[model samples]
Every structure is written in C-alpha cells, then in structure tokens.
Target: MKDHHQHELDSRYRRAALPPLGALRCFEAAARLGSFTQAARELHLTHGAVSRAVRSIEDALAVELFERRSQRVFLTAAGERLRDAAGAAFDVLAAAVRELREPPGAPALVLSCEPTLLMRWLIPRLPGFHARHPGIALRLVAGGGPVEFDGVDLAIRRDDFDWGRRVHAQRLFEERVGPVCSAGYRQQHLQGQGRGARWDDGAALLHSATRPGAWADWSRAARRRLPAGQNQSFEHFYFSLQAAVAGVGVAIGPWQLVRDDIDAGVLVAPMGFLADGSAYHLLSPRPIQAGSVGAQLLAWLCEQA
Candidate 1:
C-alpha cells in the first residue's frame, strides 16, 4: 500500500525538473489573470516578488516563457504549455490536500440486536443501508439482554424490560405477532381444513425457551386451544423461527420478524396477525445527534418499521 501511494505521488508530482510549487503558483496565477500585479494581489505577494518567481521558473526551464509589456504580462507559447501543465498538477495537489484535511468519516456503528431480529429482519435490510451510507460501517452484536451502552451505539429490541435512565428508547413499531409455518407444511396440513377446522389439534408447537409464554399468549389471543402434544423447544427464538421456516413445526413469531418470510412465501401465517400492546424500539445510551450516521440509521429503521 505504501508503495502504491508513493507511485501515485510520483506520477502526479514529478514529470519534469519543475519549478518550486510557490513559483508554479505564481506563474499560473499571473498567466491566468494576464497581469503580475493582479497575481501578486491574489497570492498576497508583491508585484516584484511575482516577477522574480516567473523569471526563476523561466531560468530553470531555459525558456523565455512570458511576454512582458508595459504594466501587463501574458503567457508566450511555451509559457501557455507550462501554465496548462502546472494548472493540472495543482488541481491534483489540491485534491490530495483536500482528502488529507477532510474530517474522518463517522465512526463505525456498534449495534446490538436480538439474535432473532438480527437474523430475520435486520440482516435483510442491511444491504440497503450499506448502499445508502457506504461510508458508515456497522458492527452487529446479537442478544436481547441488559445492554451495556459503553461500546454500543444502538440496540434494536422489543420493549419488554426496564431500561435504565442512561439508555434512551425510541419506538420503531409495535410488536404484532402470529403463528407462522412453512408453505409446504401449511399446504399439507391446513389446505383441506375448512375455516372451522381445528388447525392446532395435531400440529407440532415450536417453542422458544427465551419467550416461554409466547405460544400461550398467541393461542389466547387467536382464541385457539393449545395443542396437547409434547412440542419441540429451541434455545433461542431464531432457532424456533428457523425450525418453522424449515417446515419443522408452527412457531409463534412477531410480525416484524417474519413479515419478509410471509411475503416471500417462505412462511405462511396459518393464523392471522394479532396486535399485542408490546412494541419494538431503537435504544441508545444517549440521543443521536442530527446528520450523524447513527441518526440516519435510526431514521431508516423507523421508516422500515
């Protein structure tokens, strides 16, 4: 990398035994404005200083590069060529200096999200975010727990716990949930069942150990009797949702988490959606300032919700 950068600098800055940078600046300004006095004013140098710099450049190149008239100066044929080359060189140098002086990009966002939400919802939307804000990097950590705000910039989570005063919460969307199953499972087991059919009579119940009562709450809201059979349990909600998507069983999933799957026909909501009072929120230790990458990401999340 160092070799490549050096090569770039060499190609840009070295094409001839050029005059000093200050002399080149004086030459270009004097040639462009067609007057040594105006170039001196522009460069904050005296007219004699500009004349000496131009004479020095001409001596270095061994060419009479400018035509001097009474109180006026203009580029000769050789001087015009030098002026063009010098202007192009200065443009590249100015760009390099600008890049060096520009403030470093916003620090990469350290975000924490629930594993299930990260996998099912947030991951799918990341490509869009990256496309929009390519300068902003993201580091995602997964878990739904008491978040430590020291290293993390944002956390996407369901609002079910007491987050302390240091953490600020912004509601993204209310958590609406329903039972979802693979398309194949629904076709094989539920297609022939009429509207009054007992869908849960023999179907397997996929449970998340993290949210043990999700199935019960969904069943109560859907007004369906809980299946009596022993069901499979996963260590996390993501695993349960994966099992459901793989046609293992019916899993109670939040609408936001499973909406894409349903729309893509990977998972079908055999039962309809239910709006529970719970909500999803974007949480941070402190409020994000306007025009920051974190603020843009938060706004995008709210739009997605």
Candidate 2:
C-alpha cells in the first residue's frame, strides 16, 4: 500500500505546477463535509482514494493539512486556509461553466411599462416565462408615464389606439375603465343609489392620479354628469387598487389590471358605462424591435391578454 501510494505521487512531478483537478475536487468535497469518509461516499470512491487525493494535495502544497487522531481527521491551520480559497475558486469555476452553458440571444432585456401592468399582470406570470425561456433574463423598470426609453429594449404602455406616428405601438388589448370598489364599500355607500345617480353626487371618488384626465373621459363616454369630485386619489394603480380593495373609495382603473379583482369578488365595476375601449400597447422607439426575441414575448402577452 505504501509503495503503491508512493508511485501515485512521483517525486519527479513538479510541485510548482498547477494543482490537480481531481485532488482539488476531493479536497473541496472533504472540506465541505469535514470528513474524508463522507467525501469518499459522495464521490463514490473508497476511503483510500480520498485519503490519497488529500495526501497528493498536501505533498503538492508542501504544507501540513491535518493532524490524524485515531480514525478521525482534523483540519490544521493550513488546511482551513486552503479550504476557504478552494471554496471561492470552485464558485468562480461554477459561474464560468454556467455562463458558457447559457444559450445565445439578448444579453439583457430592459422592460419599462406601467406600474399597474408590472405588478398586476406581467410580474405574476414572469416565473413561468423564465422557466420556458431560460436563455433570456429580464430587468424590469416600472415607471408611470413616458420612460426615457433611450436604453430600454421595450416598453409596455397603456394608451389610445391612435397614438400618432412619433412612436410605434403594437395594440395588445383595449382597456375598459369603470367604478371599481370593494364589495363592502359598494354595500355601504353605493347600494341602490340608482345608476349614474351614485356617482352624480359626491360618493368618495378615488381617482387614479396616473390618469388625471381619465375620470373626465370616462364620465363623458358614459354620459355621467358627476356633481362633485371627492378627489381622494393615488398616483400608482397598485396603491389605488389596494385603497379600493380596502373599501376606501371608488377608483377607476383598467379592466386588465382590475380583472382578477373583479373575478375574485375583491372588487366590482359598479357601472360598466365608463368602459372607454382604450387599448394597452407595447411601445418601441423603433418598431423593428418587435421582430426580435423580445417581440416573441410581446406576441405571447397579446395572446394571453
């Protein structure tokens, strides 16, 4: 056994050369488990192979790694130092392997879209999309209003279908806005107030601040002569939705964002009269971007909506 082990670690082998991968592998495993026997078990080798690997490593390093006591092995100061270094080195190697294995496509996708869509629609389904498209990674920047899309790959927007010619938008789904309120709020303040009469008088109107002029457009389309605007408003749809869900006030938001709420009975669109048919869009500076892999994502979104 001694002669065979000596043959394995030749004296002619240069110690200053790069360390052996198999020996480093054995060391990392043993360091992680803190037991050579466990490392041998995991690596599917006999305890002798693991011990030999460790011995070869120690010989190469010209360092004392362990103080053997009975059957148990303890890491010396030098072993502890090498363990830390080897762990970090393995982590870097694993990262490099992952990068090399990644498929070819866009390095990163910058998605700028409405806060409402980001939270309500897009985010919830992102994990599934990632599972299917492992090669693509998305970095989302949720901002209300026109994002300086100079560096962005794509922007998901909510606007009228006829958005002029400055920017190109692919129509995804037309949104319909109406009085969205919690079930409790409708029971308290809105039950049987008569169609249009409830909103005609002041009834704690929670206006969405993102779409300031939106209430007016809704009122006009529905021919609702609103007597007063209570002006309990919020800039973000997520906030306004929460407020409405909490039975604070009646908020006006897109059907797409509030669709789940309406379905789950968290909210109810009291008067469907406010449906204006404003479509959500995927806006891009150059329309040709829609033809890229990101465009495939857009196509999926349009189908889902």
Candidate 3:
C-alpha cells in the first residue's frame, strides 16, 4: 500500500513538472517554423490559437521565448534551449514510428546553411558532391543566425554572430566581398572611369534588406565614397545580386557567390574583393570522427573552398 501511494505521488510530481503537451506542441511548431502564422497553418489552427498557446507556455515558464520585431519573430536564448530539447524529442518519436512502419535505409546527413549562400553558391556545387560521394545521402535545410543542432547534423555559417562556444566550429574559408554590376551597366555608366573611381551619382545603387550596411562596410574597406544615387532595396541578398545581373544597379557581392558569374562575364567587379573580417565555418554539436561521412564532407568542402 505504501509503495502504491509513493508511485502515485511520483507520477503526480512528474505531471506537475511538465507543461501541457498541447502548449508544448504549439511552441515547438512556432520555434521550428520561426513564425506563429506558419505554425498555425501547419497545425490547422487559427493564428490566435497558436499565439495564445505559445503565450500560455511563456506565462507558465515566466520567460519570454520570442523577440517580436515588426512582422517577424526570433527565438530567444531560452527559446533555443527549449527548441533543441523539443526537436530532439519529436525526432526520436518520429524515428520510432518510421522504424515500425518500414525498414530503415541510409541515414541522411542533415546540413543547415544560410539561404543566400545555399542558393547562390552551394546548390551550384552540390552536383559535384553527389557525384563524388554517391553513398552519402544529404538533407539540406536553409537557415541563418543561431542554429539548433538537435536534429541537424551540420550547419554552415559565416562568423558574423556569436553562436556560443558549446558547439565545435571548423573554419571553412575567408569571406571576401566587393561591389559588382552587370558588364552592360559598367559599359554604359563607367566606361572611362578608373578602377578606384568614386561611384557615379547618375547610377543606381542596389541594396539588400538582409545586409543593409554592406555598402557602408565595403566603402570603409576600400577607402572610397559611396554614390549619392537613388537606392533600391531588395528583400534578400540574392534578389539584389540578381538585380545587379540584370543591369539594375551595383550590388555588394560575396566572392564565392559571384566568382562563377564573373568568370562567365555576366558580372564585373571593377574594385576587387576585400576580406570582410568574417569567415565561413561548419558547426557541429560534437567532434566529427576522422573517417566518418561528416569528416569526408568537411574535407571535401575545405578542398572546394
């Protein structure tokens, strides 16, 4: 009788220590998707429902989980911790279900990368990787900023933000940036100008919303003045680069992303690239084994870089 009573008390304590499962599910969805609206859509719930559920979790925990900025939301440090735990828990549950349903195949190496770099540079080079290593399966996710590596095997990021010291980071390559424009735009606007000439006031300047201070950073590095021309802003860095390719205006381009375009004569970088004091790094939760697939991928990436 005493053992039974003690077991009941233990069960009650465990239940009390855990948050409501529904609220936790909502919080996990919001954190993974990075948007309340998207989470609501995925879960077939109203936006208000998702918001209230997340709020309930926050209220119970007495901590803010997300930083609301205008129309976007970002996870806080505490939120990231919860996200990692929730993601790992969900992944384990999912894998168990899959194992019951079917035989397991080769485990995929999940790699998260910055969207612009993935679109502009990595995707173009992925064919070679696949061809070289036919046995290794890859699952790529596009993201930036702080990463939750619970379910993710690897992350490729520039050393622009502090991603904490808990994870092992392997430096991949130096990041070099420069102003690039379509060759046609250069012929029309800068035909007779020297490489170090100040940007022409008549030409437009293409700017990326993601990197608002890119031009300013380049100006400081090159010791040159920016143009007093009309500025056009794009929602993403890739959009700005595409606009530059279309002869819309000059855009700050990363060397690795624009190297092929420059070589193909699609774009011209009159002022050569300069190191922007940032380097790309591969992040992992644990040290990679020497002969593992992760190590092979890392070695291949370094060779490519």
Candidate 2 lDDT (Cα, 0 to 1): 0.72
lDDT of 3 by residue, 161-278 (tens): 9999888899999999998998888876663456646567877888988999999998999888887889999898977887787788999999998998899897999878999999
Best by lDDT: 3
State, as a TM-score between 0 and 1, how close model 2 is to the true structure: 0.58
lDDT score of model 1? 0.79
Each prediction's TM-score versus the true structure: 0.62, 0.58, 0.65
Lowest lDDT block of 10, candidate 3: 91-100
lDDT of 1 by residue, 1-305 (tens): 56988998887777555678889899999988888889999999999999999999999889987877775666665776566556545644553464456577655578888876776677678768777876766767776878887788889888789888888888889988988898877776563354464554567889988999998887787777776756999887877887787777889889988899789897888667888779988898888889978788998898888
Extract clashing residue pairs from model 1: none
Q: Which stretches of candidate 2 lie over 4 Å from their true place?
A: 1-106, 160-166, 193-202, 227-229, 289-291
Model 2 steric clash pairs: 174-279
lDDT string for model 2 (1-305, tens) is: 56966865765454447578888889888987989989999999989999999999899779977768997888775776576557655654664465456786667677787766776777656667767767666667666556457778778877743445777777888777787888777776663555634653546777665677767787788777654647677765566766777677888767877887788897888776345766778877776464677787887777668
The TM-score of candidate 1 is 0.62
lDDT for 153 in candidate 2 is: 75
* Candidate 1: segments with Cα more than 4 A from true spot: 1-104, 191-197
Clashes of 1: 0
Q: Which residue pairs clash in candidate 3?
A: none
